[model samples]
Target: MSGGTWIAVDGGQSTTRARASWTTEDAAVAGFIQTTDGFAAVAANVSAALAAVPDAPGTIDRLVVGHTGLPIDHASRDRLARMLLADHPVREVVLAPDEVTAHAGALGGPGVVSAVGTGCVTLAVDAEGRGHRIDGWGFLFGDAGSAFSIGRAALEAALRSDDGRNPPSSLVAAVHEVFGGSPRDATWALYQMTDRIDRVARFAPRVIEEAEHDAAAAAIVRHAAEELAHACATAAEALPGIDRVAVTGRLIAPGSRLEREFIDALAARAAHLLTVPSAGSPLDGAARIAADGPSIYRPLVEILTRPESSAA
Candidate 1:
């Protein structure tokens, strides 16, 4: 097997992280770089990430990229691989969806995993290695248990309360305080924001804080927890004989109400599963894939080493 420098990248919606490592028989050196280009501009983002590595591109042996919004079709994957290899001189490259790396990093084996942050997604891998994905439809239609969802719910409730369509709550006052205007003015201000999804998601922490003393806010948080738990349960069911589940993302951070409510909801479902926190970051999983070659995503990864070896 070949052993040299390798780069691993975990590109997500909000931030992109890359790690460059030089490995020998018994030791390794590593460095990290972070960017905000996200998956929408994956090509440019990846190029920037690669350039951040301390070592020259020609000296790198391999690069494994697990990216959000990665194309699923083989043709598209090949096109992307070509684009990346055009500028860098890495010997081999492997690419797959970010969830594959998340699953590997969170569960490491056969189990279900729920990743909740700006968005939420649940993935399950059975003992037989069959994979199932639940939700993660993005901010517009899905991501039910995500921070974006919670923040949107809070904003809607505040708006409804202002219009006399819902009961008055602390959220209404909080919104008025933060946005600083009448309902119409607040609406106008929101529309002016460049990144509305991220701006709206900023209210998630406020929702959690208010939920400690407000009924409406508490209900929103609990419902979000229920939604996340349900996704986990559904995925677990799809992957039979799996009794372990891992939860990641900032929404369910330790010592938070969201985490407590999520656990309680799971317990209510009588799910005979061992729920645990993730052991490593997605970049770690990407590194593992680079070192060991493909595993679960063997069919999805494209190896762009030789000119003729372009397909997965």
Candidate 2:
């Protein structure tokens, strides 16, 4: 197993990826190959990712993965673990949620990372290595701060306004503009598909923009940030050693007013807000796990702190 290859599989709600790297006594090559939405679509991309990595040079030993949207129960994690072990000759496999890799990639020392994208999750880790999470619930129950959640909320608000039942939202106007001045067009597009999380989430940025100029939109943004911050605080409390908080996601794009408000709320709570040098991609963190194992959390600090790189 010494001098053997290391493999990593990162399964995300929106995408999945796999990579392999050979190690020496020095640094590793940024040998990331490709990214895929295989796990979400079908098995073909996953098979291709697996074929990309040759068997380990010596005896194949370990495989590590961070899977987003995986069932939180032991039976589910165990089943995925069995699949990895069965598919390859690796001696050991570690199966954990994507939040673990996000924490490893974003938080340094002791801090909380609120990740908001297609979904939202807050992860915290203390110096003692204990971890905590909050608001990782899927779109239906929670995900209050997620892109999908915000977009869904905006749609509901817009529809109510359109129906003359509820007050109008800037979201309606913004969405109307996006769909050629017809909110009905947008509605039809959203309703045309049963699985529209991604399509709806595409409206979040416009919602945020309108929120900056409209009171109703601003209210939604404020409420969303508050919900996200609360989730981060919950994780922080569980990790008493954490004094800093970091926020990441396309929703909180750098220098955006929403991100500014999120930072202000964290400051009000006395949580030092630090910039997490953009969490490049989950696959990068998964590769880190493959090369260094779970205990190598500290070294990940370097990867997360480096200047933002293109998504792997």
Candidate 3:
């Protein structure tokens, strides 16, 4: 049996994934934990996930962690390292921002990865190991073209239209259609029932669909697409050695105009375009990282290109 195992912990804003793989097998073990409160809660989740794993820490040769909102300072790194070390007695550990792992998961080797969810951001890593980032400003100030941004705009329009402050919007109709008869019910579901920004963001697509029939919603999606494209193109231009760009988001639905535009921008900067329809979960990506060691690029490529399982 191989003496070493590779592990990857990927923490997102809403959840965390932990993966472990033995070097000898193509298979990997993985688990997920949702983040209910915030970073501290996520940290506890990670601790519990690690504890539930069968593998002992000393057997783990290397550990790689990617967490959201980890301050890139010495104290922050030290604290996280301490947390991981508390449970896993690995010889080496590599910690990176969750965005970096998202880039790693999406682009695999070296390229730009634009993650558009509740927020928008682009990160590029050239073959030379250089990195560039753009447009990760918080929701109020920036995050243009993000789901939340689009949803917020659409919601404002819907409310305005309902009160006759603006023209009647199909957006209002779409929202009404999506959430049963009452706009109040939908609003409560979004604001009161869930703290999930991404869930709230889902309503943006309805706005996009309505845009074909409603000018206000259309303008919102168009502006969002434009900004998102700009972010992708900017990152690609700043980084060399990037021939592939991976775009991930609920907004970039297949066959949708948003996907077309995002692809066009990436294609403008890179030679190959791979839209992520089957890229494995971050947990699987993490397993590949754990089993492969230093050659993260090749292992990641294999994981991403591999056919996805049909059964859940």
Best by lDDT: 1
Q: TM-scores, in order shown?
A: 0.84, 0.77, 0.73
lDDT of 2 by residue, 1-312 (tens): 333456766654555567767532222221221235323322333444566565456534556666654545566555555555555656666665677776666653467777777788888877766677787787778788788887888877887777787776667777777665556667788777655677677788888888878776777788888887788777878866666777766678888767977777766765554545555445666666666766635322211111123111
Instruction: For model 1, name the residue pairs that clash.
Output: none
TM-score ranking, high to low? 1, 2, 3
Candidate 2, residue 88: how far the Cα is off, in Å: 3.5
Best by TM-score: 1
Better of 1 and 2 by lDDT: 1
lDDT of every predicted structure (CA atoms):
0.75, 0.64, 0.62
Poorest lDDT segment (10 consecutive residues) of candidate 1:
24-33
Candidate 1 lDDT over 1-312, as tens digits, reads: 235667888776666777766522211222112225333356777776665656553546777888766766778777777777766776677886777777777777888888876777888887566788999777878999888899889888888888889888888778877668755577678888656666677778889989999888999999999998899898888867888888887667887999889989998874587888788766677877777676665643568774545322
Better of 1 and 3 by lDDT: 1
- In model 2, what is the error at residue 98, expressed in angstroms? 1.1
User: Which residue ranges in model 3 land beyond 4 Å of their true spot?
Assistant: 1-3, 22-39, 48-58, 89-91, 177-196, 208-214, 241-243, 264-285, 294-312
Distance from true location, Cα of 166 in model 1, Å: 2.0
> Residue-wise lDDT of candidate 3 within 1-312, one digit each (tens)?
123666677665444556666433222222222334434454565665555556653445666766554544666566666556555556556666555666766655677677776667777777755777878675668888888788888877888888889988887777777666455567767776545465556677777777676888877877787787677667877866555566665567667766765666555544454445525434454554555543534322212111123111
Better of 2 and 3 by lDDT: 2
Cα RMSD, each candidate: 5.1, 8.3, 8.0
